[model samples]
Target: MSGPADDEGSPPPAGYVPAEGRGGFSTLNGPYFHRPGEGELAEQAFFARRRHANGLGLVHGGMLSAFMDGVLAGAVFRGTGKTGVTIHLSIDFLHMARVGEWVMGEARLTRATRDVAFAEGRAYVGGHDVVRCSGIFKLMSRER
Candidate 1:
């Protein structure tokens, strides 16, 4: 695992703040950050670390997939004010992201019904796209 010192001299892009209230797997995988955007949506980011890398020393596809999942879910929540469980998710791997790079992601809620929502998103490092994803979520009530 990486400590704070691993992030020395490298900072998230401007306008970002730590994303709070993340628990469970997210807690283990991240100290994620975000920048508020239009409506309730935000742009999400995380600095790649050694723990996020594959044996080849590139950021793992699984990590990027999980990040894209959060990005899409964030759109669902922000756009509809409802939380959800992913029913299906699809991802396309593009270029590579290495440790020490800042991986940024953005997503939009494409459509929704009473019980389901759809979203699309992408993760990038600088000008290069790392992954693209689309998701279907089953909306959960606020009472849950």
Candidate 2:
């Protein structure tokens, strides 16, 4: 039942889906979900009080890494219409994100082979850059 404060007034950003019930990690770092659009995929998470923060009162780097993974992986899925697993992930922390802020992550598929796809993205707080990431994902066999 943990989520963004009820008092917050902004509606969910355009194209965002509720991340609830997606699974454990999503629930922990989330109520996070994606907004897939024409050129890229955007994933969003609202930073709750303690769950996403480190001792210094900034949003933890690990949290941003997870968010990047979700968004970049999602970009691969949406781009190829295939499910994928991360084979590799890299992130660069650029700025600090504060609690009670909405963090936005956007990613786009870079290239793909028959089995692997590559992608890169960034996470932002309002207009401030927070983290940038790239990932390689192995496309799973199509389920039938």
So what's the TM-score on candidate 1?
A: 0.91
Model 1: how far residue 6 lies from native, Å: 3.3
TM-score for predicted model 2 compared with the true structure: 0.83
What does candidate 1 score in Cα RMSD to the true structure?
A: 2.4
Query: Which pairs of residues collide in candidate 1?
Result: none
- Give a tens-digit lDDT track for model 1, residues 19-133: 8887789978887899976674548999888888898879999999988899899999888889978999999999999988899999989999999999998999989999988
Give the top-scoring candidate (lDDT): 1
Off by over 4 Å in 2: 1-11, 36-39
**lDDT, candidate 2, 41-97, per-residue tens:** 545555445567787768888888887888887788778878789999999899999
For each of the candidates, the C-alpha root-mean-square deviation to the true structure, in angstroms, is: 2.4, 3.2
Q: Against the unseen true structure, what C-alpha lDDT does each candidate score?
A: 0.87, 0.77
The best candidate in terms of TM-score? 1
